[model samples]
Every structure is written in structure tokens, then in C-alpha cells.
Target: MSTVLFWFRNDLRLHDQPALHAALTSGATHLLPVVCLPAPDERTPWCFARVGPHRRAFTAAALRGLQQQTTVLGNPLLICQAPPAAALPQLAQAVGATTVVCEDIAAPYEQAEIAALRAAGLQVRTVWHSSLLHPADMPWPASDLPGVFTSFRQKVERAGITPAAPLPAPAQLLPPLDVPAPVLQAVGAEQGAAAIQPPAPPQGSDARSSFPYGTPGCDGSEGAVLAHLAQYLARKLPHSYKDTRNGLTGLDYSSKLSPWLATGALSPRQIYADLKAFERNHGANDGTYWLWFELLWRDYFRLLHLQYGAGLYRARGLSELPLAQHNQRGFERWCQGETGEPLVDAAMRELAATGYLSNRLRQVVASYLIYDLRGDWRAGAAWFESQLVDYDVYSNQANWLYIAGRGTDPRGGRRFNPTKQAQDHDADGSYRRLWGTA
Candidate 1:
């Protein structure tokens, strides 16, 4: 019997999983579903973990949910501790399979992984399902993507483009490819499960956390992803999203969907559909419109990657700016939230304590690091990649580049005056007090 390997990337959930759907229909009689965890010891150029505790713990929770779902569908999900390039080809060989199917990620590292797999002689099929609007569905070609976000959004709206409805979860997947137990144990196998069961939920979480992940209702599982969305909509929060979105603290301040989106536990298309239905039932307003606006921003960033590729990762990004100097000490202090700037410090402390930060504060802290602290934007981006539970490659890289005036921002760059930002957003300083930076 022929077998195929299904590699899980950022798109983790079975719902609306086009890549998973593709694997099921690949004509293989048997299938092996696998996920490769980032190496724990891997460090970024800044010498910090490439994936930090919150990201690891949160992603592990997502795997546990995925493993459970796959098992219920008659296939067990294998978690590999090894990198994809090393582990996948070996598993494919062991299972007597040559084709591997997965979600297509546009970022440099993810694309490099795919390149490595092809070099290893395994046929890889990558399905693009992460974006809300299909790239092909856009009015403009990828190469001619509007440099500015507003232009992109205007074109999309004028073209009346809507995302394809999310695909339903398959009732079952192909039978598991028979691999010897030794082969399974050789790989990380369920986030290195031979050594431990799925990662235990993180402990000693801060009570003041807006996301409060690793606790009940916030672990990065598909079930929790859906549950959070159901509750957020059921409580009728979309109607007020715009008004509360800028809030600096608490879960109700925003949709809090990015974490699951980052993990692939949540689907942006499904979110879009549900929100549209919500507006129909409850009536459309600026708040409801803003949610869609934000979704467009997410898609815009992904498309930007499609156009720029590795250019976005450069020191100066897409612009012709000179190379930036890395302020090692300043960057370190900013990471620790001890830069003597009350608002920026509070935001950074909250980020460290909770693996999450408000979108408002994210911009503020990023600006403080780039414009005020005179730090290398890449290092700050790296720290966020290591820290955020919802860290996304396209968004993180694009946002950092934009703020540093290194990308397509018409305004050279955004420099949020820390004092002014504090007065505007934290007028009473409650947010700062909550994180004890006051």
C-alpha cells in the first residue's frame, strides 16, 4: 500500500485545513501525519531562544489537541523534536513514502524548510490556505501588490473580493502508515513524547495577564480556539470591538484571536464568515467593519511577503536606509522592561510576565525600541518572535520593518512619543500600575 506524509506547519486545525484535505485526496492508501517542533536549544542571531517558553508551551497545547483529533479520525499525529529537513525525509523513507504535503508559508525560514525537503528528494506539495483572500483572488497580481496598505485594501474592496468559505473538518483521515516503534521514538515524536507526555500547562502564570494562556480557556488548542470565538461572538463583542480594541488591558479589550491564528488552531476565513453573519444579525457598524479591516491588514502583510521575499529580512528592509547599529545594552534593557521609560517599561514588563501584549502597547514598545532607544529593529523583532504566544513571521517582520521606516510606510516611520503615548493611552496609568512599572 502506498503511503504519504502529511506535514503540519502553522495551519494546525482540521477545520478549513485545505492542506490536510489535499493530503487525504493524494491517493495514498496509508498516511503519516507529523509535526516538527523547533529545537529547544536553537537561538536567534541575538543569542536568545528562537522560540521561547510561552510559544513552546502554547504550541505544545495545540499539538495535544491536534493529536487527539487525528487519533479520533483513526490516524495518530506524530510530534517530531528534530527539524523538518532532518526528520521528515527519514520518516518518509522509513514509511516507504516520498510525497509530503503541507501548508505553504511565505516567510524565509518556512520557505527554506520546503527547499531543504525538495533537496532531500521528497516531493512536497504545499497548499496556500493561511490568507483570508486567496492571492489569486486579488485584483492585482502579487508582483504589482500595492506598496501601501490603504491602496491594497481599497483595491480589494473595490474588487468585491471575499474569502472562500472555510472547508469542513474531514470525518476521518487515511489509515496510519505502519512505522516501527523504534522509528517513532527516534524522532521527537509528539514534542519529544518518548520522554514526556504533551507539555504540561505552564505554571506560575500572572493573574493580570490579558491572554492568560496555559490556563483554562486559553491554552492554544483548537477546542479552546473555537470556544473562545463562540464566546466572543455569543457575548456580542464584535459590535464593540472598535471601541474596546485600543484597550491596554483585559481580554475583552480585543478579539484575542491572533494566538490561535498564529498556531493554526483558528481560521481567519471562519472568523470572517462568523463576523459577517454577526453583522447581518446584529447590524453592521464601525466596530464590525474594523474587525474586517484588521483581517485585511493580516492578509496584506502575507501578500507583502509574497512580493518582497528575503528583502524584508534585511537590516534596512525594503527601503534604501543604511545598516542599523545594534544597541546591545539598550536592546537588553528594553527586553527586560527597565529602560526608565514608564509606559514603555510597563508594556514590556506585561509582555514578559504574560507572553502577550495589547496591540496598542506592541506599537508603543516597538516604537520606543526603534526610535527612542536607538536599537536595531531586527533584534527587537527577534525578541518578540521568542516571546509572543501569537508571534507571526509575516506580521512581526512587516510591522518591525514598517515602524523602522524600512518598509513601505509612506510616512518615513512611526515614532510614538512615549510621554504623549502614556498620556493618551494610559492617562490614569492603571495599565502601568498593573504591570508595576508605574
Candidate 2:
């Protein structure tokens, strides 16, 4: 029987999984689905463990949830502790497969992984489905995308562009390709995910943290995702999201959807579909409209990656700006929330504690690192990648560049005055007090 190995990257869920669907329809008789966990001890150049505890807990939950679904479908997910370049070739050989199908990530490191697999003599088919709208459906070619987010959003709106409907989870995945235990052992594969140990099943033990992921509705599982979205819409929360989105310390203020989106546990299309249904049922308003606007911004960052591939990851992004000198001491202090800036410190503390942060605070802290502390934006980006449970590479890189005046930002760069920001967003000081940064 012919086999096709389906590699799970960031896109982890079954619902709205076009890539997985591609593998199912590829006519292979046996399918081996696998996800190579980042090497358990991988370190970023910043001399830190790349995946922090909270992101690990959330991602582990996602893997387990994915494993449970595939198991019920009669195909099991194989979790590997080695890198894809090392494990995939072995798995392919074990199953007698020469083909791999997975999600397309625009980032440099991810693209390199695909290259390595191809180098190893595997025919890799990458399907791009991470964004709300596909590149092909855009009003203008993504390659010639308007250099500005506002213009891009305007053009998309002028064309009335909307994401196509999301796909349902396949009722039955192709039967699992049976790999002998010796082969699995050689590659350090954990069948049915029995070997993976998430720090805590759902979350860390911090109660004061905004995202309380350990709480019943907040874990990274698909079951929790569906329930979270259902309850979010059932409460009619989207209608008031824009107004309350800036709140510093509560889950109710934001959609709290990024973690799921980042982990690929939830689909952006699923969110857009539900938001539209909400508007049709209750009529449209600015609050409901803003959520869609935010989704469009998410798409804008993805398209930018297509427009400029490795350039976005460079020290100075798309612009000719000189690299900002990284302040080693200042960055270390900032990461520890010891920068002595009350609002910024509080936000950093919150991020370290919960693996989540508000969008406003993210921009503020990024600006503080870039403009105030004179720190390298890349270092800040790496710190976020290491800490954020909701870290999406596209948005994170684009944002750091935007603040550092290195990307296509028309204003050159964005700098939020943290003092004024504190007065504006946290005048009551309750948020700072909550994080012990007051």
C-alpha cells in the first residue's frame, strides 16, 4: 500500500484543516500523521530556551487534543522529540513513503525545514491556510500588495472580499501506517503521544494572570476551543469587543482567541464565519465590525511575508534603516519586568506569568524596547517568541519592525509614550497592583 506522511506544523486542528484534507484526498492507501516537537532543549541565540513553560503547556494540550481526535478516527498522531529534518526522513522510510504534506509557513526557519525535507529526497506538498483569506482570492496580487496596511484593508473592503467558508473536520482519516516498534524507537517516536509531558495539562498555576489557561474553558484543546467560541458568541461578546479590547487585566475584554489561532487549534475562518453570523442575527455595529477589521490586519501581516520573505526577519526589516544597537542590560531588565517603567513592567510580568498580553501593551512594550531602551527589536521579538502563548511569527515580526521603523510603516515607526499610556490605560493602578508592579 502507498503511504503519505502528513506533517503537522503550527496548523494543528482538524476543523477547517485544508492541508490535512489534502493528504486525505491524495489517494494514498496508508497515512502516517506526525508532528516533530521542537527539540526539547532547543535554545534561541539570545541564550534562552525558545519555548517557555506556558507556551509549552498550551501546545502540549493542543498535541494531546489532536492525538485524541486522530486516535478516535483510527489513525494516531506520532509525536517526535527530534527536529523534522531528522525524524521525517526516518518516518517516511519506515512507512515506505516518499511524500510529505504539511502547512506552508512564510517565516525563514520554517521554510528552511521544508528545504531540508526536500533535500532528504521527500516530495513535500505545502498548503497555505493560516490566514483568514487566501492569497489567490485577494483583490490585488499578494506579491504587489500595497506597502501599507491601511491601503490594503481599504482595497479589500472596496472589493468586498471575504474569506471562503471553513472546512469541517474529516469524519475519517486514512488508516494509520503501521510502523514497527523498532523503527519508531529508532526515531524516538511516541505513538499516540504517550511520551509527551506538558508542564501542566491546561495551564500554569497563576490565578491572577489574565488568561488563566488552566481554567476549564481556556486550555489549548479543540474541545475547549469550540466551547470558548460558542460561549463567546452566545454571550454576544463581539458586539462590545472593540470598546473593551484595551482593558489591561481581564479575559472578557478581548476575544482571547490568539492562543488558539497561534497554536492552530482554532481557524481564523471559523472565527470570521461566526462573527458574520452574529452580525446577521443582531445587525452590524462598529464593535462587530472592528473584530473583522482586526482579522484583516492579521491577513495583512501574512501577505507582507509573501511580499518580503527573509527580509522581514533581518535586523533592519524592509527599510534601509540601520540596525538598532541591542542594549544587553536593558533587554535583560525588560524581559524580567525590572525596567522600572511601571506600565511596561506590569505588562511584562503579566506576559511571563500568563503567556498572554493585551495588544495595546504589546505595542507599548515593543516601542519601549525599541525607542526608549534603545534595544534591538529582534531581541524583543525573540523574547516574545519565547514567552507568548499567542505568538504568531508573521504578526510578531511585522509588529517589532513597525515599532522599530524598519518595515513599511509610513510614519517610519510607532512609539507609544509609556507614561501617557499608563495614565490613559491604567490610571486606577489596579492592573499594576495586580502584577505587583505598582
Query: Which residue pairs collide in model 2, if any?
Result: none
How would you encode candidate 1's per-residue C-alpha lDDT over 1-438 as one tens digit per residue? 899999999988999999989999988899999888888899999999999887887887888888899999989888889999989998998989999999999988999999999999999999999989999998878999999999999988998999999999999898986777777767767446642244444531678999988687897789998989989999999889999998988889899999999999999999998888888888999988999999999999999999999999988798898888878999999999999999999999888878899888899999989888789999999999999999999999999998899999889888888898889888998988987878
Candidate 1 collision pairs: 79-189, 79-190, 81-188
- Which residue runs of candidate 1 sit more than 4 Å off their true CA positions? 194-201
lDDT for model 2 comes to 0.89
lDDT of 1 at 213: 84
For 1-438, candidate 2 gives per-residue lDDT tens digits of 899999999998999999999999999998999998886578998898888877877888888889989999999888887789989999899889999999999999999999999999999999999999999999778688999888999999999888999999999988886788877776777633554565434365577877888776787888899899999999999989889999888779999999999999999999999888888898888888899889888999999999899989888688888878889999999999999999999999999888989999999999999888999899999999999988899999998888888989889999999989999999999888988888
- Global fold similarity of model 1 (TM-score): 0.98
Error of 1 at 382 (Å): 0.3
